[model samples]
Target: MGEHSKALEYYEKSIKIKEISLPLAHPDLATFCSCIGGVYSKMGEYSKALEYYEKSLKIREKSRPSTPPDLATLYNNVGQLYGKMEEYSKALPFLEEALGIFGKSLPSTHINIKIVMNAIDRVKEKL
Candidate 1:
């Protein structure tokens, strides 16, 4: 918790500085937003985390190629957050989207596929 708060404070400060110099839709801003979202998620602030995650996702989708790992990672993060919030119905779609992207982007034997598969399964069980 202590580490998350510290990280959150730093990320917020850096993001503020970045916002002035960078365009509103810059990919770097997305990265910082995602980082802040991770910190919030760690601190159990799910809604706040989702807000940042969605912000990051919007920018990333617009700026980057759709097949990249980071986009898939963002999907996974949102999915996991939904799962944590016990929104299993909402969680399934995001997790499945992550799994699809991971499948297309990562090697067949990659560990990420297995991890996401397990997350999807867990969400399904809860549903």
Candidate 2:
């Protein structure tokens, strides 16, 4: 089940299926890459995680409409990874980018956007 240990495997399977069936640079594939990247991050393979995340970002940039939610989510993921690695300076840019995206996509009163903004502020303060 998805809630169990097979979650990552399922995500990978889905990604592979999408990659074969979908067009190049499809948003679904990009989302799959992001999911895989998150899994890699959880597994403590930061480099691999980053590689997937970057790949996802590229696909989103090329294929998706420039929606704030999408860019912000990707940036937040990259920023969080860098934050985990103690690369605060590198993290700041990504977090800032995410914040900018949120600013455009969601209203200021939106809970998730505000939460992301708070996180960016906290990280910036630490940096």
Candidate 3:
């Protein structure tokens, strides 16, 4: 818990600095947000995790021409977070979207696509 708090503190500082120096929709900013979101998720702060993940997704959606792999990752993260929150209905669409994007952008045998597939299956079982 102490280690996670320390990491979160550093991540927040880094995000603040990047926000000042980088464009609003910068890919690096999105990545930083996602990293912070992951930390929050590990710390069991699901709302904070979802907030940062949504911020990351907003940036990616505005800056990228098409659905990038990172956007897919954000979807997967948000979906999993909702699952952790036991919001199975909320989790389904995001997981399905992530699975669809991963299917199109990644190779058939890629681990990411498989992971999304497994998540979708798990969510379905919960539903």
Candidate 4:
């Protein structure tokens, strides 16, 4: 679990396999990219994390419906990554977008909506 490099290796291998078997725009490919982004984020490689996250976000944007929850999750991931990188100004808009989508799609009191709202508040405080 603490083996970040090992985790990354496996993630990359899985992505390669999925890429060969799945369509370019497949949601599974997006998810694979997002998983890699998360691993990079946990390793504190913020730039790499952002790159993979942007890849996932772009794929999801093209493949998923406009208001899919996965899109909100990717936005939240990018926002949190920016926040962790101390780029709060950049984080706020992404977090706010996640908050808006969660608000529209989830119950008012849903935990995800609450989490996104709290993240937005934290980013705003940093601004």
lDDT of 1 by residue, 67-87 (tens): 787888899999999999999
Whole-model lDDT for model 1 versus the true structure?
0.92
Clashes of 4: 0
Best by TM-score: 3
Task: Return whichever of 2 and 3 wins on lDDT.
Answer: 3
Q: Tens digits of per-residue lDDT for model 3 on 61-116?
A: 88898877788989999999999999999999999899888888989899999898
lDDT of 2 at 24: 77
Off by over 4 Å in 1: none
TM-score of each: 0.95, 0.86, 0.96, 0.95
Task: List per-prediction Cα lDDT, in the order shown.
Answer: 0.92, 0.84, 0.92, 0.92
Task: List, residue by residue over 13-120, the lDDT tens digit for candidate 2.
Answer: 888889889997898888889998988888888998999999999999889677659778999999989888888898888888887888888888987677677777
TM-score of 3: 0.96
lDDT score for residue 50 of model 3: 95
**lDDT per residue, candidate 4, 1-127, as tens digits?**
4798998899899999999998899999999899999999998889999999999998998897778788999999999999999999999989988988988888999998989888988888888
Report clash pairs, candidate 3: none
